[model samples]
Target: MITAQTFKRGSRPRPFLMGILNVTPDSFSDGGKWDSPKTALAHALDLIEQGADIIDIGGESTRPGATPVSREEELSRLLPVLKELIPSIDVPVSVDTMKADVAEACVALGASIINDVSGLGDPDMAMTAADCGVPLVLMSSYGDPSTFRTQTIPGDGVLYAREKLAGLTEKALEAGVREEMIILDPGIGFGTSPGQATEMLAHSSDFSLGRYPVLIGPSRKRFLSHAFPGKDPDAATAEACEIAASSGADILRVHDVGRAAERF
Candidate 1:
């Protein structure tokens, strides 16, 4: 199970596995397949059996150009799964949301981590983390989460991501979230073109996470298509995960926990 201490710089294991579970109907990958609470809970349990160290559940889709769901809609899809999934799973449960109300509700019901892909787009999100004292995953992206589509690309992907992440980290710090309790995500494919995403992945260690652990969510991102054209997404994702682990990423957020656990 994951705890605030589980991600402390010196105490972290090498590339712990975080399995993805999207309960939305529009996520780029595996959407609509587990939108129901029963199916979602079943998948979460299977992830644990597959050697997942943490299970990440997201209600809204963050795919590029995807439409955003209302807060009420997100909670309706999310809360039910949490209510049934948390008590049934043994591994730490991480709620993937950018809204404060959703995070609060999940925490109250036993979520141990908050993986907000919006990088605190919601004003009250920072305090939600501070007040709950749960580990926060601050992901860097330019546009809205549902549509992380970007018309402009940064010249230096590393510098751009570092600056974005640094700013978000500052916000989290000011909100009273401990540095050790924070985790950094490069937000691969979240507002980046294929090249930009690749550049950042190649130099993940240079993000200089220090006390804050770095998590790389390369799973089945579309960018993988460029890296390995003929390769299946899972195969491409596995290769990318290997590169990320060798590059010093502390956590690997993946779709296939069984394959990842076996490789790592």
Candidate 2:
């Protein structure tokens, strides 16, 4: 399981695995497959068994152009699964939502981490994470939520990601979140142009905000879709994971736990 000690600088050379569990019907990948509480719980256990250090569960689809679900709707889809899965799993579970209310509710249900892909899209998200005292994953995504996938980096992707995360980290600190409990993600492939995303991912180590652990989610993203297209799904994902790890990513957010466990 991931704790504050797990994220200490120089503690991890190879990135730890954080499996993705999206309980939404519109996620670009594997959507509608595990939206049910029972199936989600089963998949969570399977992931843990397959060597997942953490499980990140999201109720709403953060895929580009997907409408944001209401706070209540998100909780409705996420809470029941968390209620059944938290007590059953040994590894940590992170609630992936930009809404502060959803994060709070999940934390109350014993969630160990908060992964806000919006990088504090909800004004109170930082405060909620601080109040819950859980590790917060602030992924650097630019522009409006509606344009997350199509948003273009104004300049260098690495610089943009780093600067954005740095500002968000400051906000989190001022909101009472300890610096050690903070984690950073470069939001690889969330924006436009495969080349831009590739550059951001290649220099992932440079986006380390607050000197915190960097978590890269390059698993099966569109940017990597063009690489080795006809190969097995995990083939490209494994390569991306290797790149992220080699570039100093501390956590790998991915879908295929079995393949990552085997390779990493």
Candidate 3:
């Protein structure tokens, strides 16, 4: 079980809220509206008021088929917002990036967590997190944004994700990252179909694999779109998030904080 001390070092034994702040022009939801530092900070504060435990800020759009942004462009978009919000927000700040440079910079700027969707496939990423001594949330994905959805895996999608995450966790630990400083996310909708995502959520315990806390992000995903074709995608996404929280996930990464908090 994850204790308070472990959490302080950054691990959660129970479900926690991780609010999303996408600082990109092409993010699937609320992209340009919060792209600027002022608006982003305001939105982050609003999420905090609505019961968010952590704020995950991301500059690049990692939605499938999305083009990669340059490091300079990503940093320009993220640092300003992070600089403003870090001082004002009461909860931990997580920078969502796969690049080692960006991760290092964010850690230096008082961010406590590194949410890497690449699972530290970039060799320097794990070393960077270890060097900075911050908690790292490693999400399991088959590939990068460019070709992730094209990759094929054997067995159930949730089990495949779990196996990949397990391997990454071992690699990260071996690379000098403390065990307590690591968290696992199943990467819902990253490379799986709508049915696969649902199956993963239904059998989330399988992803736990062992004692590590599982972090789930089901907010505003394409899977939710397919799950509720006629209803509002946003609403369906929030419902999916609620299901994840109720199904033994340790953290819920969401865009609609108010609705999510109400559901919780």
Candidate 4:
């Protein structure tokens, strides 16, 4: 349901919910819960029923210190689920990947969006997105999952995010992606500290890249847990969603799609 008109900047759109469907055994939040195709498909359907506007499917875990999966392994895990789920879903389907090959394959298999948490770090990633003619969620991140956790945090997190996203916006545009197909994410926990993440959330609107829509994914993140000790991560994630909605986020990527939809 996300289109070029739906992503206009300078004006906030009715916040749309992007449900997370991780078909991996090592994702930080719901590892091993929906690793199978049957379970993953069922969970995705449930999310759509609960009001998810988009379904983001990921085969690899981008958790801190996580081991990176091979391109073939990632393809193995995702293609099976996407092959079946895309044909059945009513809303748009996105593939969460940083690999150019994986992104290309998924788009060919009917994915509408490519959510790259690495901010187009891969040289071919931007080109793949352009060739597919799908929207790309380029997050402000220093490196891949294995190295992002150890990257240096800027003293001014909001400023750092804005600058990084600006540079990435140019990269995406130069690679031939249409301006409206680029969505910017601040990469809340990728390399940010607890305070840094909070700062970015507080200033989400400032991180927008010209006319590009902003997608905020603070769902069940470690920074949220660190902010409220002993509090339920789901509750914290919901609170973050509320903040993001008010701060000009056009799309919210989350695990609890129903709750986020209600909050938005």
Encode model 3's per-residue lDDT on 17-67: one tens digit a residue.
Answer: 889999999987777889888999999999999888889999989887888
For model 3, how many clashes? 0
Show where candidate 4 strays beyond 4 Å.
Answer: 1-5, 8-13, 147-152
lDDT of 2 by residue, 57-146 (tens): 999988778887888888888988998998889888888999998899899999999999988878999998888888999988767657
Error of 2 at 229 (Å): 4.5
Off by over 4 Å in 2: 1-5, 8-13, 227-232
User: Mind sharing the TM-score for model 4?
Assistant: 0.94
**lDDT of candidate 1?**
0.84
Per-residue error for 253 in candidate 3, Å, reads 0.5
The residue-level lDDT of candidate 4 at 131 comes to 88
Q: What does candidate 3 score in Cα RMSD to the true structure?
A: 2.9
lDDT of all predictions: 0.84, 0.83, 0.81, 0.85
Question: Which pairs clash in the backbone of model 4?
Answer: none
Q: Write the per-residue lDDT of candidate 4 for residues 106-224, one digit (tens) a residue.
A: 99999999999878768999999888888988888755576666774758878888899999989989999888788889999888888888777777778775577888899999888
